[model samples]
Target: MLIPGTHYRLAFTQSVLALLQVINAPTHYRLDYPDLSLILALVRGGSLARASALLKVDVSTVFRAVRRLEAALGQQLFEKSGAGYLPTTLAQTLAEQAERAEQALEAARIGAEQGGEVISGTVRLTCTDSVLQSLLLPALARFMPSYPALTIELCTSNDFANLSRRDADIALRLTRTPPEHLVGRRLADISYRVCASAAYVQSVDSHDLAALTWIAPDDFLPDHPTVAWRRQQLPGVTPSYRCNSMLSVTELVRAGLGVAALPDFLIGDGLQPLTEPLHGYDTALWLLTRPDCRALRSVVTLFDELGLALKLP
Candidate 1:
């Protein structure tokens, strides 16, 4: 005996009332995407300072956001112990949900960016100078022009970029153990050899390791394998030239300043190996990206491309 469309009207009224109840609910807070993202950052970083760095905000801002979120929810989310901000169970759950939302949004953004025929968006890459000069730049030069809309920012440094902070989208690193948080594949084995200019190699008695003028990494890199090798293997030998950077050491050796240990990739045409691959100095080169960033087209493309291009023996 209901009127025509009466059921539809009732359903619409019920839907509106439910929405109103949610809006009026005492537990409701004006939570936005950024607020949810902040929670995830806090949980991941475990401290105001770390969260600040991750979000590119100040510590004070993170602190205030935590306070605001706590006040809005009427529950404690984090415990400020001496170590750092430890997330409570509620905070952890919320962060997990937020992470899912973040992933969805990121996927949508990436889709929009790649909606066109050409893959678009910027990818930031970080690596050492030797890797940059020898491998990355050349590979990029050949293929990057295909994606004219895509931008690549290369940051060359020996130091590790803070992947947690999103300082770089991708990192090519030479390390025995890559960070646990980063997900990547080992591209190749990095081997070091005692190298010098061809002329210098011919001039010096390569077998008489002690008599050759040595170039060593300076105290800036106290733990450089070359430093330890020189100290342990050639105890009485003092370096005639000490350079702070591996790139500098490579250049000096190339310029015929003295014999120095260099990565096999860095020893180009003019250089000759005085010794075979140093046994204990070997490390694997890794192509790494944050788990969250690996899904982006640009990062994925470059990472796969580099992995293929630099699959050295």
Candidate 2:
């Protein structure tokens, strides 16, 4: 026969034992374990089917992962409606924490790998195709030997590269004024000048500028600075061809198609430069970076090298 006080104590001890059992659950019972990486991948992918496609996993696998997560937390983390599942408050909190952890892990990896004094990491440089063909490639050939540690990623697109989003670290541009947020060097006062092949000159009678057909690029519209200048300077000049690429235009002119505007550098490679001016046209070429980013060791070194090598006073 136990006393009433002893019986109370025994009951209390059992209650505490039950609470401890719940608190110290096995690793398999914890939802916030290593499998949360999959949960985060789903959060980014937005839809189950999309997440499955992105992860290259079956839809059922993703469903099971989420189900296991919900069970571990003992909560309904998503509300499935006619329009697909929406995350509950608990899921949102988990997603935020997961994102932070993912970013931290990435930063840790970068820091670990690049712990030395060497300046390294990938740097993307954007420029026009023509510029790349004429200038960047040769420059890079020379540039590579010195800084073997640094890698150059050359991306050529006619459309502007957004420096704010890190689309490119440095850009070679033909704009007179760079965007307000960007710092740039005036690489050169790039001017477009009209020229024709020696054969075209012989056939068309180079003296008659208005009579000869003008060769132009498709995107160089009449309203463009170059076209506008030509129209104002050489009125009633009809174009013989409008090709998309500068290389194409060069080829057409090479075959005596008609007179075309050639960049100075492109003319250096045996195409022949025209001494006479056809139309008054001029524009500046720029190399720019986000002002905040110029301090980066890689950006600064590239900027200085390109400006000094290319931009002639």
Candidate 3:
């Protein structure tokens, strides 16, 4: 039976791999040029519009190019999601090798321009700092224990990591959709819940919404769209304090600053989930990488670990 969302080349690869097994070739099958680049682009941009925009081509031109590529190879690269496209499983497998191949191609380009060459070397990776304390650090602890020979240069911050320019091997963020060129995953649907410490709840006696104190994220001001949205849902509520770090927000909430919208993963042990809504808000967490950097054994290992670490019970 044919699966609806599978990449088109998988059939060919399966046959090729089976044949290769009989002949016992010590290698893997890989895609050729432009098709590789095209697939990478679509995956990274997350939408046809973004891909076309970034490439400085008309959307129609990109559509035609993709059709041509698909015809030549007889592969359907992407499957439609509500308004975007996700790579098929075969696309994912191809992505693993394509990412490395793209890197080698980049090296060739570098060598051509500089009239020089260099050996392959390891790269550093950076991502959200909270993931370090909540998800990443623990995942690494488990991952590192097994891959003892692997050396990782890790940095964690909320800011973007530029993989195209090789700033990091991978990154994670709470965004709806990532750019097309990166081969990545939407690891989880991160949800936010307003929470407070037992001591703080005891202090607030007001049953009325108007009198309740609140804790807000630094970016959430009275006029901000997100804050405004929350306010519509939480009428008469106002923040008592604002903090940037999730850790700091948790600390303030514990110190009786007020109720804050915090991820379940970010809150401390034994805190009660606030039944009241925090101006109703939610955001997704994304795992990102340059398309050319997907599925390096190191990346695969780490990605899987991080996914497991971030999964909600």
Candidate 4:
């Protein structure tokens, strides 16, 4: 019969040796994975210079990364062609796998970053000049102080910012239909009305819209609802002052330069509404974000706050 202490010692020694053997075993796949992004960029960009530009790295860095990947895989991933570096079948396969991996990694990273209890980090917001000036700015005054850790970057543009490319984290838009790719909440219906400076409204016959001096958006924004309404309502009328930005038009109108069709949200203290809230020109105001970005705590908080603010008189 074996002593209990001796038996225990024998078992412990065998367990440790077994663990060491498992630990020493060579992994089927290398833990030091190749730089997938560099490889993908090279394949996508087609040339060293192009890849360097795309990755924002030096050409030598791209060359070195490629060389390292080739050395690890023990194969030539690309061949020199007159057009560009032609990726081999193996390279193509690897690139495709790498893209999927990159997407997965990005999703994971976003999840980890946004999953925190505290609402923080920068939230990029995009909207039109009028909306930014009239509505969002005032709302942000109250909202910003509450979330001191959160920062907001506002981008004002007439054209829709690309959320997929990360042009903006959030978009406030007046549209009948928001982009299908984005996830959002429709806050409220925005109404357009003929507006003028208090002095202009008092001076002119408000009913004779065609007879009044008009301030219009520039040729670039011909599709603007106000432009369309003006085109329809005053067929032969030409604007006295044409401006590119709606904010500029508002300023001009407020200065009593010309009457303008303005959104209800933008008619501040100086401007007077000449017409009843028009029905056909109404569009819904939407707060939109990338599906992935909606998970972020800061984004969620801002979105909720904005919705609440808009509801207020």
Instruction: Show the lowest summed lDDT stretch of 10 residues, model 3.
Output: 18-27
Give lDDT tens digits, candidate 1, residues 1-313: 8696454344334333332333333777655556667888999998899899999999999999889878886778899999899998777766766664454444445555767455656688998877898888888888876666567788876656557678899999888888898999998888888888988878778889889998988888787767777788889999999987788899998888889888878888899887888888788889999999967987898888888878887
* Candidate 4 residue runs with Cα over 4 Å from true position: 1-117
Best-matching candidate per lDDT: 1
Model 4 clash pairs?
Answer: none
Residue-by-residue lDDT tens digits, candidate 4, 64-114 = 888876775566788989999889876776676665545444444455566
Q: Each prediction's Cα lDDT score?
A: 0.78, 0.66, 0.63, 0.77
Deviation of model 1 at 223, angstroms: 2.5
For candidate 1, the per-residue lDDT at 164 reads 66
Off by over 4 Å in 3: 1-123, 220-229, 235-238, 276-280
- TM-score per candidate: 0.61, 0.59, 0.53, 0.61
